[model samples]
Target: MDNVSSVIEFTLSGFDEILDYKLTFFCLTLLCYCVIIMVNVVVVVTIAMDRNLYEPMYIFICNLCINGLFGTAGFYPKFLLDLLSHHWGISYTGCLLQGLVIYTSVCSDICFLAVMAYDRLMAICRPLEHSSVMTRQRVAQLVCFSWLAPLGLLSASTIFTSRLKLCGSNIKKLYCANWMVAKLSCAATNWVTSTTPGNVIAYVIILFYIFLGVFIFCSYVQLTRCCFKSLANRGKFMKTCVPHLLALFNISIASLFDAMYMRYGSSDFPQSFQNLLALEIIIGPPLFNPLIYGLTLSQIRNQVLHKYLQNK
Candidate 1:
């Protein structure tokens, strides 16, 4: 207990084997971070500035871009610093904060996707009623739920985590994660046996993802059925729903790689490969979401081109 009290930081081991290429990795990471910021900001600003593009679908897409920024911000700065200094450690408080930001951002990604799913379902299947059903008030409520629900869930997990007496001060990954931090507690076994607040919150978080996965699946299933029945509906699906589906697929694969690596990763794997697996979620979505949306959403793409042409 006393030793736990004295521990103030957790050492990250993800960068240990990359020291030989730190300079190259740092430049690549810095470039990647800047690109993520520029692309997502372009989509967000395009949507915000154009009143003609104001609609529920565009609004949700904008929120998704904002989330990509929020989630990546938790990681890239700290990672860049570690790459430069060769010091891969975070303060205990910093670890929890990072964990909170990263997890909530991921959760919010799924949440927004689910909301967008529902919006598409309404737009394509109930086109006549889409305007009334996805009203301003309703869109506002869904957007708030997408952010606030995850914030509340992750906050509870973080609060419960703060109560544990950590028995270890080393983390295996590049950034702190809630599950990794929870695994360090002296009461790791008790997290499963004694039903502590941390364990309860952890279970709820898992169940929430399960529910979201099912909700998204069902939304898309019905959407597919509706699209198949009519040619016009299929065109609508191609124009609008395809981008969301592509974004969902990309983020899902990246997130699954991350979750699988966290739970089942082994030292037998090369550190560089392991780092790639660990970083897939943060890297892929932040870069791809903006590109996916900007290219596929005709209104946004045209607006972006118009802005560029005007500048010229």
Candidate 2:
């Protein structure tokens, strides 16, 4: 309890064991961040500039890339600095802000994917009604919902977490997360008591993800049924839905790995493996989303290539 009042910063110990290879890791991380920015920027610019690509699907994808940039910007710069510094510490306010940014970006990502799934569902299962349902105004509304819902949810969670009286100044991971900050609250205090604010917020987040998972699952099931009914539907599924599905799966697995590891990870595991798991969510999806969509979506790929040839 004595330690609670003086704790103004958290020491991130995740990098302690990696000092031997810090320079190597720093270069790789910088390169990866650069590539993430460049690739996502290209996709976003290409889509935004080409009026022909201004459909509901491309709009959703452009939003996804923007989110990738938003999320990684919250992490990579700080991470690169940490790799170069002797000590890894973050002020309390900065920690909360980072958690807010990263968590909201992630939640927005899943929300976008779910909305994209619904978009595909309408396209395939209700083709005749697709245009009527997914009008530009409607797409704009959905996009706003995707960004706002997560922002509001995570903002509440972060606010609740900030109210907690933390008793420790050590975070195990390289980055600040809401759960990590919540874990630092004094166990004997009112804030961490049974049904405390932190617990309630955590439960809300879990429930939200559960609801999202169920919604996406049901949407995909219906989409699968619809696609199986006709050759034309199958082609539509392969053409647009496949890339979304692939991106969804990639992010899902990455996020799940990080979540499961955070909840149940053992100290017996190698630190490198632990670090890799911690990094998967940030690295895997941001890098993969653009590449997957760029390669698979013919319109995007052709536009990118045509632009490249024109410059060449």
Per-model TM-score on C-alpha atoms: 0.96, 0.95
Relative to the true structure, candidate 1 reaches a TM of 0.96
Model 1 lDDT per residue over 201-291, tens place? 8788889989988998998899899988999999999999899989999889998898778767655888778888889988988899899
Q: Candidate 2: which stretches are off by over 4 Å?
A: 1-6, 188-195
| lDDT of all predictions | 0.89, 0.88
CA error at residue 277 for candidate 2, angstroms:
1.0
Cα deviation at 16, candidate 2, in Å, is 0.4
Q: What is the C-alpha RMSD of each candidate to the true structure, in Å?
A: 1.7, 2.1
Residue 124 displacement (Å), model 2: 1.1
Candidate with best TM-score: 1
* lDDT for residue 136 in candidate 1, whole number 0-100: 96
Alpha-carbon lDDT of model 2: 0.88
The deviation in Å at residue 188 for candidate 2 is 7.0
